[model samples]
Target: MATDQEPVLGIDLGTTNSACAVVRDGRASVVRRGDDRIIPSVVAAMSDGRWLVGTRAKKRRSVDPVNVIYSSKRLIGRRFGSAEVQEMRQRVPYRIVEGKNEAIMIEAGGKVVSAVEVAAHVLTYLRQMAEEALGRRVRRSVIAVPANFTDSQRSATRIAARLAGLDVIRVINEPTAAALAYGYIEDTDRVIAVYDFGGGTFDVTILQITRNVFEVLATSGEMFLGGDDIDEAILGLMVGAFEQQHGISLRDNPVALERLRAVAEQVKIQLSSQSGAAVHVEEVLPGQRSDLDFSLREADLRPYVDPIVRRTIPVCQDALRCAGLSPHQVDEIVLVGGTTRLPHVRSIVEETFGKKPQTSINPMSVVAVGAAIQGAALMGSLVPMADGGVSAPSAAASAVLLDVVPRSLGVHTLGGYVDFIIERNSAIPLEQTRFFTTTTDNQRFVRIQVCQGEDEVFENNLKLGELVLSGLRDAPRGEVTVAVTFEINADGLLEVRAMDKETGQQQVATMRVLGGLDDQEIEQMATRMASAGPGPSSRGGTVVSR
Candidate 1:
């Protein structure tokens, strides 16, 4: 369906697996690599100094436990000292070291690589696969992210796309994208709830769709919860069973643990379709002569997983409350992410909504399909459907999306109180300005301590970064008024600008995101990637060129 023009791709850069899709002839479908539609988001460093991506990389995890790096999504755009990164370091087999600017880095392939770089490799593989499937060059794309992603995380995702040589036209939220895929072409206007429980993160979003406009009323979720937790629960059960059988704990052995993790994931999938699954491992323990076999019934695993699935209920209820709507007010409940395939997950969702959730679309590919529709709509290439709505709209007509900021943004004052600039759930692509003056007489500069949270106490919130507005006129405390502007862009990334009221001059301030790479570092990595070209074994014998 693509002509000479380069096609735009919609990529779901997920934690457990990633996918891509495109729009053709007013319909959206997923792009596949040979017979495979989902690619594992794993990367491995070969002994020959080459990198392996996707399935090949995932296979190397058990063999080269120290070199294969998966779940880099959890580390991307995270501070080295943050609680999340510290937790990840303890769980993963690869080594995580602090890099410049306190960014999280991993030791792989005899080199120190930032989480951004590792993620870039996965993005590159997806880009190549899309191009090959379309039989044309693919550059522009719309990438999806969690609804609760912070400014640094959003910025880091954009940078990763750039490193992969893709021009990201927009970064849409995952739940919003799912809604678009589900109701974009429906003729009726209604309120829909999107429950996106993915591999690495979970997000619940409430949206009101009217004609061609989709407005996100409220969004909330746990950044650390998802299908990964289910896998972890099963892994723990296996670990206990193995230890009891062999009288030895395999937790200390990274290689054996990795092997068991793979089996646990498979069993988790099998249990979804069947009442029980048999998990068998041969030579699982060190120097073991016998095999370990165990029967895992759906009922036995439900105790561990049901509690985790129930955790999502409060988040969903909170989101509905934020939207000022009750559960019955919601017309349709759409499920997204692979974890939604679980029978218990669906049952709980139905009970919560008093309605059956829609699962006609493949949960794993819905987000990407929705993103492709958005991309096509943005590019003015979508053709209007025969119905009142559009399966795909023309270039002259595009749907309007109104998103909101997930958290409140403010600055720390002299009294250690937060001066709220932008409130949470405020419609995004918004700008607000507030004026502040120095507290001390003849103060030469003022410090702006930016933070993100609802806490009134400055220290209780997460510190985003700081800015020092210098070269101010040495006037009385209240006389030197400065106007500070806080802007949340369409992609939900924050930007601040300060100006002197009297001189009308923009103040020079340092804007450093706490867990993000600096311009210089990004540029250096771009240069290195360009010079190195594609890794020798990156494609697992599938030819890829720079």
Candidate 2:
């Protein structure tokens, strides 16, 4: 082992919960805070203006349903116009509004809060929990992001951590983090796939590992899919039951609907460990004391969620196709995420992959544990970096994180067409160069719109950023040659720049990122949330609301 000195923490911030682990004495251990390894990823504002996180915030949901913010992860780094935002608005009980600077805002306790600020509160809480568990002033950490998160999403996550006062050491993909955690157990030599189905994201990745060399062959995912979708299905069932019993629709009441959804989530968790679970719906209206309890069997639950589970199959097949492998060719299938705990989810994987997935490791903690291992390796405290700096920790100054461009990267071309430069799954920490020319004769400047996605039309794909190469001497169209380079680093975030290679002059252009909320806007909203505090008559029975 090479002697590198420093220590860092690893955090997996999830939609419903957050987990932290640290590498100590050559092993990774889940760091507990107040008797909980998995802290509820909810933040509530109390009447006194203090923020309550984790379990306390979760309890406050029953009383102060309006002020508690859960699952804000879906809104982070997203624009108001995105499909995910549109769908979330219809499904989630919380109010999401377009705020200043196009930031996504959540209405809580009579105050409108930005999604980033809510996330910052969660991050701040996790950081303190880790610090308390580790008994040190933790500053740097490794965070795990979904394999399919876009540039804006990753940037948003980084900003949230920065606001929380922690130095983000690195952002590793979730699948890769799980692979690192597995690789530490036994220096495995084979190709492995990490199938992650979380609360709000689904990612299937193929990785090759041999002699400390870990390479990601392919990755594919749907950002809107996950365990929460399954919960919604069960919630729909509860709604039907309530309608039949009371001869009234609960869906019309947002407060009652939100409470039912929360209880449905708990029932889903219980069903995973037991065969039958009962959910009691108390009188949701004023001066009501009657309760409606319904018991659901596992078989009854399977069909309701089969379609959602089936959606993951095609995504898995697509990932395998991208990796140029059939299901039989994969040596091992590793499961990640809390959703994988469901029996039906496991059965579907077994039927599709033709192999039993390894669940010896807790799917929920694997990502965070793996992240801690990588964090320790990065700090040079556990594993040593390699000399060539091209492979694992034993070989490089920077831990070689070979990430892939999840979607195609391109620039808008003539007639509204998009020309592709880098295809999806291209190894990261990678650089690709493409040449462009002035579209108009005697043009002194060229505008290039950088985009991500596989569509041929510019409008169909995501507009990531833009660049304009100016001050070029007037020349015939197609005469002035400009070289554009797209560089994606280990964190899977993009950086694009242009140069007149012929003149060796750098291009001075600003990038207009579509659907991104800036730091100033996020901070301003956070300040407002802090000042407004929580509302009265919203607290009761160990439930604290802010």
lDDT of each: 0.83, 0.77
Candidate 2 residues 1-546, lDDT tens each?
Answer: 443334567889888788888877567888786678887789886765556778888888877866778888888888777888888888766688987556688876666667777777777777777777766777788988876677888888887887676688889877778877776334556888898888877889887765555566778888789888888999899888877777778777867776787788888888877889987666756577546677798889999989999999999999899889999988888899889999899999998899999888889899899888888777763442366443343432234444567778898988999998888777777889898888799998877898888899998987786777778877788888888888887787888788887787888655666666655676775565444332111221222223
* Error in Å for residue 345 of model 1: 1.9
Q: Could you estimate the TM-score for every candidate?
A: 0.87, 0.82
What's every prediction's RMSD, in angstroms? 4.2, 5.2
Best by lDDT: 1
Off by over 4 Å in 1: 1-4, 184-189, 209-218, 232-254, 274-304, 321-324, 381-397, 439-443, 474-477, 535-546
TM-score of 2: 0.82
Model 1 lDDT tens row, 431-451: 999998888888989888898
How well does model 1 score by local distance difference test? 0.83
Q: Report residue 490 deviation for candidate 1 (angstroms).
A: 1.8
